[model samples]
Target: MADRITLTGLRVFGRHGVFEHEKRDGQEFIVDITAFLDLTPAATSDDLTKTLHYGELAELAAGIVAGEPYDLIESVAGKIADEVFAKDARLTEIEVTVHKPSAPIPLTFDDVAVTVHRVR
Candidate 1:
């Protein structure tokens, strides 16, 4: 699809890490989702029903990020993509990015993230 809807900087708290401390003390996770679909229908009709409701999409992704504890953010990204695809059939493709800013790395880094792309 040529048209897309994107949501960025969605922050959620979750206990998702390999270390025990990480599981015990949850951290924040940032998520970004890009949903690709034909926007012609919605644009032409000027109706919300013809397009994906971004608020609902954000809620769906936020639930996943806050609900599960995964060893990897890669898994988190994949789960978001899977759930997003399941929630909306109109989307032709989706890109999910999970950011771990407070990752337990020994070295100083600005951020750690994983991105996944899925096509329907």
Candidate 2:
């Protein structure tokens, strides 16, 4: 069985949007991350090194979101997945979900989201 660790609803201010106004002002984004890792060693030994530190992952993800200005959420999510893979080679798989709060649309809606998964 795959012991998965998850970080959800990580909020950050990022400049990712289709329009200039949207990009200039920026908006709040929510990110959800899932990492497939074996936690047996950590559970048995009770060592932080044996398991993933979700807070560190969250900070890393936030740095990516705030650092890159992609026009599409798909691109953002893809980059996030790539970043995660680059950081942790041990992760069997990684999933990223990005929520765009200020998406341009005709009708009223909550937000739009994009999810991407990568495996090593």
Candidate 3:
């Protein structure tokens, strides 16, 4: 199996939703990205440089989400997928989950989340 690194529960505040208020006021969003890449070198070398830095990636993602205000979560998820690929070319595949904890819905619910997978 290849090396797998997962960044979980990365929280960010962004304007992403179908509602008008959601786009204007924004909401809390959670991002979870699972990356699959080669780990043989990092395993043997035990060097930080040899492995993917998820912290950096998460920060970059946050910046992007904060910068790019998309109307829908789907666009946000797609941007994240594109951003991850731009950050690390070695990432063979990535699974991205975007969660809207404060969705403006009439019914009571915990949150609304969307997950997407992209292969490079």
Candidate 4:
């Protein structure tokens, strides 16, 4: 679908990394979600029920990011996509991006992120 709902820069704390300290200390993760679906029904009717509730979407993503401990940001991205797809049947597709800014690396970098795209 051409119509889409996008939620960006969702920050949540997560204990996800390869190292032990990462799991123990935890860190912040930023998530971005784009859900593609037909918006004609909601737009014409002006009904909230006909469209995806972004607040609920944000909560869903936040819970996922804060709930699970993963070894990779890629896994986090995938999980977010899976959960979003499961939560909304109206969605034709979804793209999820998980950002890990405090990743343990020797080199200097602005950010590290992984994106996962899923089609229903």
Rank the candidate models, highest lDDT first. Answer: 1, 4, 2, 3
TM-score of each: 0.97, 0.94, 0.91, 0.97
By TM-score: ranked, best first: 4, 1, 2, 3
lDDT of 4 by residue, 1-116 (tens): 79999999999999999999999999999999999999999999999999999999999999989997999989889988998888889999999999999999989999999989
Show the lowest summed lDDT stretch of 10 residues, model 1: 64-73
Off by more than 4 A, model 2: none
Give per-residue CA lDDT, model 2, range 24-114, as digits (tens): 9898999999999888988999999888888889989999889879889899899888988887777889999999866778889997899
Candidate 1 lDDT score relative to the true structure:
0.94
Local error of candidate 1 at 1, Å?
2.4
What lDDT tens digits, residue by residue, belong to model 3 across residues 16-94?
7677777788878998888889988899999988888878889877986777677778888888888888878888998
Question: How would you encode candidate 1's per-residue C-alpha lDDT over 1-120 as one tens digit per residue?
Answer: 679999999999999999999989999999999999999999999999999999999999999989979998999999999988998899999999999999999999999999999998
lDDT of 1 at 41: 93
Q: Give the Cα lDDT of each candidate.
A: 0.94, 0.88, 0.83, 0.94
The TM-score obtained by model 1 is: 0.97
Instruction: Name the regions of candidate 1 deviating beyond 4 angstroms.
Output: none
lDDT of 1 at 5: 98
As a TM-score, model 2 comes out at 0.94
Stronger candidate by TM-score (1 vs 3): 1
Clashing pairs in 1: none
lDDT accuracy of residue 70 in candidate 1: 91
